[model samples]
Target: MNANHMNDIRKYLKYSILNNCNFVGHERERNQIFDLIQRTIRCGESNSALLIGPRGSGKTTLVNDVLTGFHKNKSFVSDAILVKLHGLIHTDDRLALKSATSQMNLDNAVDGKVFGSFAENLAFLLACLRTGEKHTSKSVVIILEEFDLFCAHHNQTLLYNLFDISQSAQAPICILGITCRLDVIELLEKRVKSRFSHRQFFLFPCEEDSKESPLDHTIKRIECYLSLPENSRLKINGAVRKQWNTILKALLEDKKFRSTIQRLVDVDLNERTLRNILVCFFDQL
Candidate 1:
C-alpha cells in the first residue's frame, strides 16, 4: 500500500524471474548424476550411457542439464546435438537421414554408407562443427532421451551402430541414452549390452534416498521463495508461510496428490478451486 512496501514487492518479483529455478527435491542425486555425465565426457570413454528411472524421476531433466551445461562451458567450442528419437519414431529412412544431416554436416567427404548411416549422420553434424585443425578437446555428446523406444519399435541395429560410432567417431560422439524401463537392456542384443555396460547410470526415486526428505525439500523451496528480492510480490507472512508449509507437507506425504502437486507447484495456483481450498483452510486457522 505504501511506497516502501510497493518497492519491496517489485524487487522480489525480479529476483524470482532472474533465477528461473527448479527446486528439484532430489538435488543431491541430481548433482551426482551430473558429475557422472561430466566424468564420462571428460574421460572420452567409448560407450553409450543409459539413464534408467521412473517417468517423473527427473531423468529427462538431468539429460537436458548435462547437454546444456557442457555446451555452454567455455572449453566447449563445438556444438552439442540432442536428438529426441521419439520425435522421429514414424519417420522414414530418408526423413531420419535428413534430420541427421540437418543436425550436422553430411558433406560428400564423410562416407554416407557408413554403419548405422543415421548415426553417422549425427556424427557428421558434429564433425562439421569441428575446427579441422587437431587439438585435444572434450568429445561432442549426442543425447537421445527415450532411446529404448527406438530399439523396441525399430530394429536394434541402429543402437549397435551408434555404439560402434561412439568407439570410432572422428568428432567423438558420446551417446547419452535415457529410458523409463530399467529392464531395457534385457531387450537389447548381447553386443549392444556389452557396449552400454560401463557407462550406465540409474536414477533412483526420492523415496529410495534417506538423505532427501519431503520436509527438507519443502523447506528449501520456502527458502528459495523467501530469498526472492524484497520487491517481489510473494507475500508470505508467518501465518501464510505456515499455511503454505502445511499444504506442501500434506501434498508430499500423500501419494495421491503427487502428480497434482508437481504440476501445481511449477506455477502460481490462481484457479478458483485452489484459491477456495486455501481460503477455507485459512479461515479454519
Candidate 2:
C-alpha cells in the first residue's frame, strides 16, 4: 500500500476510536438512573443510589449520559450541581469530604475552619450543602467511582455521612456510588447498609438470544462504526470502504475469531473491548 493509503486507514481508525459509541442494550439500567435523577429533583430532597456492575459494563457511561441529559433539560436538574470524584484518589473519608467541598467551591467559606475528625468534615460538608441550597434551587449529585475501595476505610465514615446528609430535608444532596463488586454493600455497617438499601442498580452483561447472538452484537457495533460517512477528518474512498467492510465480514465468518469474541462477550460483554479488537484489525490495514 502507498503512504497515502496507510494514512487514510489510520485516519479511519482514529475517527472510530474518538467517536462516542451510541449506548445500546441497557434499557433497564438507563431507566433506573433516570428515575433516581427525576426523584431527586422532584422531591426537593436528597437521594442515594448504588450502581453495581463488572468492569467496562457501561455503569459510568450510563450515569454520565443521565447527568448530561439532566443538564440539558432546563425544567429538570439544569441548575443542579454535579460533582464527580474517584474513590481511588481520596481514600480517606475526611479527605474525600474536603475534596468534595472544594469542588463545591466552598473552600473559601470553610477556609480557616479546622477539620480534625470525620465528624468535623461531615459537618462542614453539610453546612456547605445547606449554603448551596440557599444560593441555588438545584440539588447536588456526588458520583463516587470505584466505590468498594473507598468503603475499606476505617468506620465507613464517608458513606455514613453522605447517606446521613441525603436523609435531611434541607441541603438536597444525592450520593451515587459505582462499584464492581456486588457484595460490597454487605461490607457496610448496619446503619449505612440500612440507609443505602432499596437503591441499588445492577448492570449485567447482555444476554444472547436466538435473534442476536453475542457475535451478532459485535458485528452490529462494527457496522455502526464503519457506516460513518467520510468527512474532512476521515476521507475514505468508495473502494477502500468496500474493502474494509469485506474484511470485517471475513473476520465475522472466521470460526476462531467468532469463538474468541463470543467467549469474551459471554464473560463480560462490554463495548470498549470490542472497539479495541476492531482497532487492532484496522491497524494491520
lDDT of every model, 2 decimals: 0.55, 0.72
TM-score of 1: 0.60
Model 2 RMSD in angstroms: 4.1
Candidate 2: where are CA atoms >4 Å away? 1-9, 12-21, 74-78, 115-120, 129-137, 208-211, 229-269
Error of 2 at 231 (Å): 9.5
TM-score list, all predictions: 0.60, 0.77
Compare the candidates by lDDT and give the number of the best one. 2
List model 2 lDDT by residue over 37-150, tens digit each: 777776766788889988877787778767777777876544466777788898887678778878777788887877677767666655555534354445778899999888
Residue 130's lDDT within candidate 2 is: 51
Q: Which digits, one per residue and each the tens of the lDDT, describe model 1 over residues 40-75?
A: 456645446777777655576556655566667765
In candidate 2, how many clashes are counted? Answer: 0
